[model samples]
Target chain A: MSGFIICFLIGLGGSLVYLLRRKKSVKEISLFVTFSLLGFIVWLSIFLGYKVSPDRFFGWIIDSIGL
Target chain B: MENARISGWQFFLLSLNFIVGTAFFVRPGSIIAVSKQDGWIVPLIAGIFAVLIACLWLTLASRNPGLSIVQICTKVAGKYFGGFIALLYIWFFIQLAGWVTRNLGDFMKTILMPRTPISVFHLMFLIVVCYAVIKGVETIARTIEFLAPLVVLIVVVIYLFTLSEWKWERFEPMFQVSTWQLIKDSLPVIGFPYMEAVTLMMLVPYVKSRVKTGLLLGITVATLLISGIVFVTIGVLGVTRTSHFAYPLYIIVQELQIAEFIEHVESTIVIVWLIWIFIKLCISYHCAVTGICQLFRVSDRTWIAIPLVLFISGIAILTHENIVDNIAVDTRYIFQYTSLYGIVLPVLLLFLTWIRRFRKGESGGSA
Candidate 1:
């Protein structure tokens, strides 16, 4: 939750700054920011200590259908 | 030809995102499972040995200042043969996307939507990734730069969040894996995630500036440093447990229960991994589509994205019968061919261009 807040603040700050002088397309900025938030979210979860495996039955189903 | 496309920072950071994904979440855990708790040695080996491969990429990019890897291949290898090589690379990238999709889908389904059909999940991912591809590499690079800092901050916060999980003695007896085995294992680790930066060769000519080379290299190195943080993860979680998870990093976040009241934070992790895989898939899919378009001499590549997405979805389905097979098979191939195509071939290209340049002198001009 705290990480999410921080990400929002940072993103807001970025949005404000970009809103000032730059004229890059909204689509471009939105796409970039979306990816940025995504990256942050990913790192946040990993840092929080996520576990990964593909051996359990669910992992098996996922790999079979999607991998 | 003269368009100053992606900035050096943008290209480097985007390329770095590739390294930062599923590998960071799972590598240290995976290595420790295979080689035991001594996995802290993997990142160092990855960092130190990867320079050679990176330098080879620089050589290739420097030779043809304005040509993409595909165009350069055409000039160097000639029309028919070069097109064939490019097609092979396209195939490699499609396979790469398939592997990423499976890894991501397996993680998401197991952790986020326990009852949802994995195919539905993959189709959703394919839609987002294909849309991003249609937007072009500039969109991708810009996306990465803006995301890199947030990613760092988020991970740092999470690190602090899970600081209690950091068991000190887990890292004891670090050298137990033997130098040979550590180095050997690290090769595959680096090859798949780190060394694969060589794929950025395709984007070199597209950089906004060549002077940003050093900065680009820095971004890439730091990306691996983020991977080094995984060693901290393995130390905290215990390698034996982490390897057992398909989405180890997801589980890591799921473990973060603040004050014991705010628990089950897996949704945040799921969203993030989904985005990472989406971006990875987008970039690889873009590369594949563009590579194929160049091979077939198609005018506009955007039209091919949908059909290609369908084909990729098919390949994703066929990649494995189960998560166990997918990981075992995909990891092995990613380790092997990612190196061959990503590092070795580019190095070989550099040598070939070097010799040809030497023979032709300034007239050839490394082109």
Candidate 2:
């Protein structure tokens, strides 16, 4: 778990630094940060044994529609 | 957006690779499982429907030249509604990228490196794909154009090498499946590689010319090749065993023992499939990134590419529990899910365009 966090932080920090150095627009940087953070949360949840399967969610939707 | 213009030949290869995609490895078993001995016919049926769907997409695209499906959505449906529609497509493309990524990870873990974590495969592959996508579509078009012939050559070679195992008797109990059954079973096939070719709509405007001929030929040739692969698979592995294995083509290659020295070549074949899947993922990832850029009016795809790759890897890991669950969801829900983008939306857009054109003609006539 510690290893995973360190690796995630490295990736996040590396990309953030790269984007900053390039002087991207605010909207672009924010969008990147938002997506990166969302990705972090998702992987963290999975690491913590809390997987939210999209296939099941989709299956439920299909069942509800009687397809 | 990057002023990238691919030639008609590159467009043809792109369409062909996109349709074949991961379907080459993952889809055949399910198709065979459903259609039984006559499974080879499913691609033909699905290809016919796919051509019809492609017609809808082409007509819509030709009428509004140089505009991608995303731009067309915003143009035809007005800003608010069209933006919403475009958003749905972006999600679809992302979801598809997730699936393709997961498929690669699953295949790698199950077959090649059982000890390594599936996440490793997913992350590594996505990072490479992200790089290609960031480089722009011309890079991708050129890369695939170079790789496409090698893929074809390898497939043809595999077909040739496996001919010694072919048996005509395997097809003896043919046409036993009723036409209705064949069509019904082919729905998932259509929804999959065929309808999924709607992703090519994202690339149609990139081609310099001959969009119609190139697109149709790509679909036609891919369909024929895939049908031939399934036909050969059924002949070699027979219906019962072919339907059972998860990667039947892999199994066929594994069993290929020419002169007793040319053996265990499945690993080499896996490399070829890796190229195919890479091209497929790149196109979907490209479309998703492009869609986001166009929809949001974002100028640079570079910043967005890395972030989206991370999100896609997360979705890939979260999408399914295992291969069985993956296949089950696909068989049950994929057709209906994809039809919204592939069939319903294109038809609706074409109809609306016709209606608007007619109204304009009427006003002009009155004037």
Provide the RMSD of all predictions against the true structure, rounded to 1 decimal: 12.3, 1.8
Q: How much TM-score does chain B earn in each model? A: 0.90, 0.97
Interface RMSD against the true structure, candidate 1: 12.3
- The value of fnat for model 2 is 0.66
DockQ each: 0.02, 0.70
Docking quality of model 1: it rates as: incorrect
- Poorest lDDT segment (10 consecutive residues) of candidate 1 chain B: B211-220
Among the numbered candidates, top TM-score falls to: 2
Per-residue lDDT tens digits for candidate 1, residues B1-367, read: 2233777667666666766666666565566667667776677677666666676667677787877677777767778876666766776777778767877767767656779877677778887888877788888777777766766677667777888788878776667777898888786677667665555666666776752464356535754565566676676787778777665666778878888799887676665656567667777887776776565555445445654555566556556667677557545545555666776667666776777777789666767
Q: How many steric overlaps are in each model, in order?
A: 21, 0
Model 1, runs deviating above 4 Å: A1-67, B1-4, B210-226, B330-333, B362-367
Instruction: Give the lowest summed-lDDT range of ten residues in model 2 chain B.
Output: B27-36
lDDT of 2 by residue, B152-182 (tens): 7888889999999999998878889999999
